[model samples]
Target chain A: GAGVSQSPSNKVTEKGKDVELRCDPISGHTALYWYRQRLGQGLEFLIYFQGNSAPDKSGLPSDRFSAERTGESVSTLTIQRTQQEDSAVYLCASSLAATVVRSSYNEQFFGPGTRLTVL
Target chain B: GIQVEQSPPDLILQEGANSTLRCNFSDSVNNLQWFHQNPWGQLINLFYIPSGTKQNGRLSATTVATERYSLLYISSSQTTDSGVYFCAVDQETSGSRLTFGEGTQLTVNP
Candidate 1:
């Protein structure tokens, strides 16, 4: 089975430029998430999508960050007017389901990640 | 938001040695997972043990939900085991959102 996959393993962007990172979740995964990991830092939650329900945007650090998951397969995280502070590795993960009951036992499979470097 | 903490921010061990990594959370969680991020920054899922114990090859993990903590054990470590180990938890109130700990950096010397 194919694991989750992300595009443009590495991206160097000028500050204030926008960038779009893409993720393809495993077939049938009902839950998808985005996270950012800065150098020598832990991962910070960005956004999450569960089925067709409203996405959880509480974790998005600012309005410049937004994510969209089409159906239950592909997801894109876009950063408008990127800042140097936004430079980090963006990771995508997916699971079988999003409900707490099902998520209790379901392991989230992560993608290789997209490294965004804002200069 | 739930807080997650990992112990021994960094560790160095000779190959074949065994080590234990700990993760303590401030609140109850519905999901707890262990991940290994290799030198290349690829996150590999190690375990999804929110409760009880599970082992795979030389790695094993146990989570005591009631106690609000989990432990990951690696035995007979190899140079390839040199990486960062992270513990992430999804608090009951956060639905499926995972809060990750700072992670433990492990260095295995031959």
Candidate 2:
């Protein structure tokens, strides 16, 4: 694909229902990241996947939030028992490799983002 | 945790005018980047500048690693340039997780 892509550009769900967001990263990119943007605010890091393993999941808001990557391709972020506070735009990005550790920092290319609204 | 702060939270400019946005980080970072979020909420990479300066067309950016600040300059702005500008960084202490600023909302009028 030319760039990172995400599914279900807009999703509306009830407060207690669970929701899942999917991300398809750029081909051959081994590192993927997830972020969340609330209304009138900058994005907040949710998790980072270096290949299939997530080295950093510190930003996950709570136990309700979790993500998994399939090898180096697709990734899914699941919000279990969503709340009104979970409403936000979920963004996915991919890079050639981990930044800083690599000899050259790889720029992360982001997807169109999934706007999740919990009623 | 490193905190990112962006100045001029809101900006209004006439088309063909110029503007400058500023970003300051609380700690050292291994990488820094500037991104433009369009009205559609898609993030566009503008510059991957951790240090030094880079120019592309009417947009230019400069980062002073030692001073812990970065500046983005947009010359001859257009209505299409109106949107939100964000500054993000990766620090070794945080496993290089990208932390973003609150962003500056820019409005360019014709």
Clash count per candidate: 0, 0
Candidate 1: segments with Cα more than 4 A from true spot: A102-105
- Could you tell me the TM-score of chain A in candidate 1? 0.92
Model 2: what is its DockQ? 0.66
For each candidate in the order shown, give its overall lDDT on alpha carbons. Answer: 0.90, 0.93
Residue range A1-119, candidate 2, lDDT tens digits: 99999999999999999999999999998889999999999999999999899999999999999999987799999999999999999999998878545234467889999999999
| TM-scores for every candidate against the unseen true structure | 0.96, 0.97
Query: Model 1 Cα displacement at A26 (Å)?
Result: 0.6
Q: Give the Cα error of residue A108 in candidate 1, in Å.
A: 0.9
Expressed between 0 and 1, the share of native interface contacts present in candidate 2 is 0.64
State the local distance difference test value for candidate 1: 0.90
RMSD of each: 1.3, 1.1
Supply candidate 2's per-residue lDDT for A3: 97
User: Candidate 1, A49: how far from true, in Å?
Assistant: 0.6
Q: CAPRI band of model 1?
A: medium
